[model samples]
Target: MHASAQSQQHPVLDYAISHLTDLIAFDTTSKYSNLAIIEHLRSFFADLGADVSVLPNASGEKANLVARIGPADAPGIVLSGHTDVVPADPKQWQSNPFDMQKRGSRLFGRGTCDMKGFVACAMAAAPVFAEGKLKRPLYFCFSHDEEVGCLGAPAIAKYLASLDVPPELAIIGEPSEMQLINGQKGKIAMEVTVHGDGGHSSFSPQHVNAVEYASRIIAMIGERSKRYEREGPFDQDFSVPHATTLATIINGGVATNITPDACNFIFELRSIDQDAAQTDMQALIADVEAALLPEMQALAPKARIDWEEVFSYPAMGDATGCETFKKIEPILPARGGKVSYGSEGGVFEIYGGIPSVIIGPGSIRQAHKVDEFIEIEQLSQCLTFLDSLDTWMKR
Candidate 1:
């Protein structure tokens, strides 16, 4: 039945929509501090009698929130989502990006689908899991800066691991259209800056051109990506089917008449196997420094290249066998699937020692779009699924 139609009997759906409305009002873009939204969530959960903790970054600008309901000594499932979102240009949107607008069956807003929708559902269900009779704990894991990189999840994972009764498994709510996501590729993101000297265009030969060297590195990355696509070390489960690397952003040069002084570029590798991918990344960086440094140094002794790690999240292997996964088997999708997108699941497993599954409301296609939205039907679907989860926990 439709979400609006089901709302009369489904108070959870009503509460979810109410929570989502308030959540979307926060401008939690990655570029800005998300402390406001984090505080809001903290208060909400604390008021409901759940144990809530806020882990802040060194700067105290961003934070990850963990909320627990039930006995502290019992293992439980984690409900995860990111609080931050990509920037939304007001010009591209029909209404204010922070204002949730109901249009037909969809709720339009910047983070309505990318995340906060699932967060709303989890929050709405908090009371259910907090009842005195709850057998095990229910943990809500929310992080910041996921749009930039999964910068906050590691802290949450580590914190969970440090607990006496850590989470056994996690449900990463990342706009999966309520389907079970068994696996996903990991990501390795890096930023490389080439330093050189600027000079007149006519004297380019005498001065090292940073842009030119950056292009060489980009070309090398392209060649490696091509080889991976053409060769056999592939996993047919992922849509891309192979490790892929590419330069996503680059900045260099000034006037057309002047040789650039410096160039900065960013690149990433999305891989089915993180070990192999990391190895390839290290080799690629080494080759660039070896091959291009000499040429640039020959012209200018001070010329050099620097590389910095942006951020990365591990790839999730199939989660069908996870202990917590089996509990919700009745509601899981009949068949499993893998995605090229990276998520906190892998890090939760590797870092927190928790197995994980990815499932949530809304399609990823709605994420980060001009008029981002989540279907009301999907909201109902998530509530129904959560009911099944509650039953499992009660049993």
Candidate 2:
């Protein structure tokens, strides 16, 4: 059967897909502003009688949208998703990355799987939720800059916390294939800079080599990663089953004939235990300062090793006994696992003090790749999940 014909047969699916297509057309790349999409949603929800609030960044370029669809004075459920997507190259895609394409059972677009599908489904279900007599409120938290170290979700979470009656539970609609995701590793992104004196290659012995020092630190990171894998605090649920760390980007010398004066490398530690990761990172820094820095300084007075934490987010872990967990359990599948990728779910859990779970359509594998797509079946499953949520809220 043709997808369009099938969609027409199911108006709810058709509406959801229509919204998804509209959402994908917006170039809400993390590097650019998401204000355009934010405004569109603001007006769309306003027309639906939702109390919409836009939280703009200091520059007023990007913003987060918080739309409430029920009683004002009570705590309720929050449905959250990020509006920004990773940049996509047109040359790499079969179709325009920003234009949603449907072929067979799949819908292709930049954010189709990574998560605009879930957001669209949430939006499509809004009218149903608004029409119902709800005992509690329902919130749509659409945040920006999530692809870049979760920069926007913290602000949204902070705003929600300040509300007169904060939400009791938050459902972060990440690409979890509709299965409940109870936990994920925390991330700490850092940049390490090694500074040395530039000199001719022939005089390398006299000059401190920044690249050499960078290599030493990279090796140290690898050693620590292995230690964590073999040591305790392992959660078998995760594919890696242990916290991990790795160097992602590195750059050094300008010319082959010159000894590089500066070297910079970016690395990240994804950990199940954030405190342990912090302690280990500090120990690595101390090792460099005590053992490597002095020797480099002996050769060049200005030589130094500096570390900067670029970003960090807490780990999301088991909220099994919380009211939110019990309430959603009946509708959620029995399967639950940990994802390695980071999301705003942690911010909601740790900072907002709201017990949260990650459950939405599609798989993370299809996210942030060429020809990114989500299955039509997945969108239908998400609709069913939202229908269950609506029923739960009515009770």
lDDT by residue (1-395, candidate 2, tens digit) is 45676566456998899999999999999989999999989998999999999999999899999999999788898999999999999998999999999888899999999899999999899999999888889999999888888888888889889899999888889999888888888899999999988889999999999999899989988887898888957988875789888999999999999998999999999988766778877887887688788889999998998899999988887776797678668877556688888988889877788887789899999999999999988888888888888898888
Give the candidate number with the greatest lDDT: 2
lDDT of 2: 0.88
lDDT of 1 at 105: 81
lDDT of model 2 at residue 131? 92
> How would you encode candidate 1's per-residue C-alpha lDDT over 1-395 as one tens digit per residue?
45578697677898899999999999999999999999999999999998999999989989999998887899988999999988999998999999999888889999999899999999888887776466878899999888777889989999999999898889899888898888888998999999998889999889989999899999998988998899947888776789898899999998999999899999999889867877888898898889899988988999999999898888887878866677768866545477888788898988898888889899888898999999988888888888878877877
TM-score per candidate? 0.94, 0.96
In terms of TM-score, which candidate is strongest?
2
Residue 247's C-alpha lDDT in candidate 2? Answer: 98
Residue 392 lDDT, candidate 1, scale 0-100: 79
Q: In candidate 2, which residue ranges exceed 4 Å CA deviation?
A: 1-10
